[model samples]
Target: MESFKSILSAKGPSLFLLPTWMEQNEYLTAGFTSRNGGVSEEPWASLNVGLHVGDQDADVVRNRQLIAEAIDWPFEAWTCGEQVHGSDVFAVTEVERGMGRLSRASAIADTDALITNVPGVLLASFYADCVPLYFYDPEHQAVALAHAGWKGTVQQIAIRTIEAMEKQYGSKPEQIRCAIGPSIDDCCYEVDGFVIDKLQPLVQELANLVNSVPESMLTLVENGKAMVNLKQINRHIMLKAGILPIHIELSEWCTGCSSDQFFSHRKEGGKTGRMASWIGIRER
Candidate 1:
């Protein structure tokens, strides 16, 4: 069964929620947003949650506010990073809450992951076809969100986030729950020699560690290109980092294929709105 459940509302942002997480803990709110029900103009037609995507700042802010309202989270609790597509994971504190909610300058600088044990501080990251990685350490009451494009994936952002959680909050990977959200799948994500070359070593390393075949992670095509399954690669990284196979939730929604529900950077020719992946523990 697909772990990310779609919830369509008459008004407010459409969402793909992690039902098990929500059911197990009422204070927990974690999900990815769809490209519907917000206030933005073309390219960023509606529900664009990114500040630096050439969309009007006011419109982006409004769309984010709509998401906050939809999730019943205070717009003040919505925090974000500058998302440089690196493996840096920033530890968010109360002071950092709402820092990047409205503007890019206020966001955590040069980071692709945000982890926080602080209750009421929502951590969000923008994506358009790139992978959205979520982590929750219930024992420590911590949650994290990582934005992994090809660059971040190659840099092992998923493992980096797990390491950050362990270092910052004493979160054991065995105890942490992970979710790989919607993104472009191998079927729609084709890479040339440059990307395939960079990925090959990492895929080999992961395969060796997990005792799996490297071919399962990447498939070669004509002209020295390959179709890479980033979600599976991230999952393998998580498993190699000590997270149990059963503890990870993988979403089947493909942004490249579901253009009507998601904004795909590749499918849309680099001009599109961004969706948000958010996770936070509410204050009681």
Candidate 2:
């Protein structure tokens, strides 16, 4: 079996590889499993964590169990959201823990962001082409996991999430470690007119900074006017929000192009299964 010991030791929040230390019971470790690891059939084959994707519930449960076991934890401690694609962020508190999907309804609703200070409380959010933003504040022992698609991205979900962490847990951006997980990269992520127009205004200056045409036109630019690196844009949002660029780690892997490794909705035309990302501080 391929191991992630070296990958984890290398340091950076955007690890495709899981760390033994992080899995060792009391560390603020975070990792996302690729579509590469488990046991299922075609379409949902190998390590598919998404439940509603037509993969049998038994297979989904078994797959999730393998994923959780690989991460060195029981599936029960893991908390996941229904993922409505909005910018709502939730605080995983004592009352909310154990009351959510591992058993019943989530403590919150219509949310895409999850924050928790309760160790052993693993919070998960789903994504395919959408970006997964994982936030860990060691100072406050709090962590947040968010799923940001184009809509959520334009809405400034990253900034809003950082703001929420500060408002509720007294977390400062400087002390936070943020990782932007695997998603459709700039090169392969092409969009349409409506999206560009809606995003252009909100990301005017920000887009200008990342979406440069400087004497060159990009085919992917909607209406042949603007092109963008959504990952960089989200990174910029975090930077402006006070997250250090050095502290922010991004996976160079693009879901759209890396079809064998990840499940991309665009690459597969909406027939793809989703991937889950999470972070937690152990109670022990």
Which one is best on lDDT? 1
Output candidate 1 Cα RMSD: 0.8
- Candidate 2: tens digits of C-alpha lDDT, residues 202-226: 5656546555432221234445545
Runs of candidate 1 exceeding 4 Å displacement = none
Q: Per-residue lDDT of 1-284 in model 1, one digit per residue for the tens?
A: 88999999777888899999999899999999999988898989898988887999999999999989888989999899898878998999988989988789999999999999999999999999999999999899999999989899999999999999999999999999999999999999999999998999999999999999987889999988999999989989899899999899999999999998999999999999999999999999
Worst 10 residues of 2 by lDDT: 5-14
Q: What is the C-alpha RMSD of each candidate to the true structure, in Å?
A: 0.8, 5.0
TM-score, per-candidate, Cα-based: 0.98, 0.84
